[model samples]
Target: MIYEMTIQFRVSDISKGQHWYETLLNKKPDFIPHDGFAEWELLPGCWLQIAEGIPSIGSGPLRLGIDNLEIERDRLINDLKIEPFDIYSREEVPVKWATFSDPWGNKVGLFEYHNQSEKEDRKKTIVGKQQ
Candidate 1:
């Protein structure tokens, strides 16, 4: 059976990429095994990998769940100098989301759930596991 998973995003410079991701995630990488490589365990079993190389033309908008999309977006803009992006939502959808790109053109996004109880429950579960 399938188990944990990892997703990778390439960058032209490893040190720059590592610093950029650290600023974006607001935390240091969970692991840096060797030169030109770093990893962050975003969730319990989900890992994000950064490697030094030419980035893919159209790689990904690796979306992350947040407690406050607007707050995070504003911080990304003011602190990271990211251009302001639109936040989108659908009547049928339960979350609001926005997409932006990293310095190396790696697409990234953030999302916030509308249902407070659901969001809190998920946070509790993840935080509990981390504890």
Candidate 2:
């Protein structure tokens, strides 16, 4: 049983990133240390933090999903000046989705859950009909 986890973000400007996160999460950051560290307690003990740390390529991947894909995508572009790419598709899995990188080049995703239950959902068959 898991309670919470932090989504760590590395940024060129930690303060600016923290400000952008405040807007995105619609809440003031829980804390901002003078020394290039800021944290927003997203849920209970969980947090999303930005720090002025060096970024490196990593094997572990992180992703986040949103119900409103377009709105989230636009906000990143308009406010944070981050670029994104659409990799996997909605029709491919009955849900619209895309990937975005954070200011520190961490991969993130945007998703719209048009279908939640997998059992009732239909898949395309060889005959081009619902399976």
Candidate 3:
């Protein structure tokens, strides 16, 4: 028996979906099937796939994990043009994670280590959100 972990996103438009995902993943897809789909091999088994449809608001019992969240957060903001739907953080937590909504409403997360400077920055944001 064999198992394939493919996460499918129903996109509103395949072209826009492809561009949005390309920006996030930093490359074009490894494959395109027919006129309605693309395959982005994000990890060894996990794939980011988009096909023609209305797109899901979100249906998550799923997430892509990383060793550190803050580093990626910085890159996403500075290098990859990520604007988050929501940002979350805490001073004491060693992980700094954020969420981004793709063009067709798929969710993407970026993360980095909560080093002292990052912790201070996030602490302010978290504290500000509380007020």
| Best of the candidates, lDDT | 1
Which is better, 2 or 3, measured by lDDT?
3
| Model 3 stretches with alpha carbons more than 4 Å out | 1-3, 61-87, 90-94, 113-131
Candidate 3 residue lDDT tens string, 13-96: 888778867866779999897898999877556677888888778644235444456555666677556573444778886666
What are the clash counts of all predictions, listed in order?
0, 1, 6
Q: Which one wins on TM-score? A: 1
For candidate 3, the 10 contiguous residues with the lowest summed lDDT are 59-68
lDDT for each residue of candidate 2 in 11-44, tens digit (9 for 90 to 100): 7777666776676666787887678888887545
For all predicted structures, in order, the TM-scores are: 0.92, 0.64, 0.64
* Order by lDDT, highest first: 1, 3, 2
Candidate 3's TM-score: 0.64
RMSD vs true structure, all candidates: 1.6, 8.9, 10.0
Q: Which runs of model 2 end up more than 4 angstroms from their true locations? A: 57-61, 90-94, 116-131
Q: Which residue pairs in candidate 1 have backbone atoms (N, alpha carbon, C) closer than 3 angstroms, thus clashing?
A: none
* lDDT per residue (tens digit) for residues 1-131 in model 1: 76688999999999989988999998999999999999999987889999999998557889999989989998999988989999999999999999988888889989999999888888887666325
Which stretch of 10 consecutive residues in model 1 shows the poorest summed lDDT? 122-131
**Candidate 3 RMSD computed on C-alpha atoms after optimal superposition onto the true structure:** 10.0
User: What TM-score, to 2 decimals, does candidate 1 have?
Assistant: 0.92
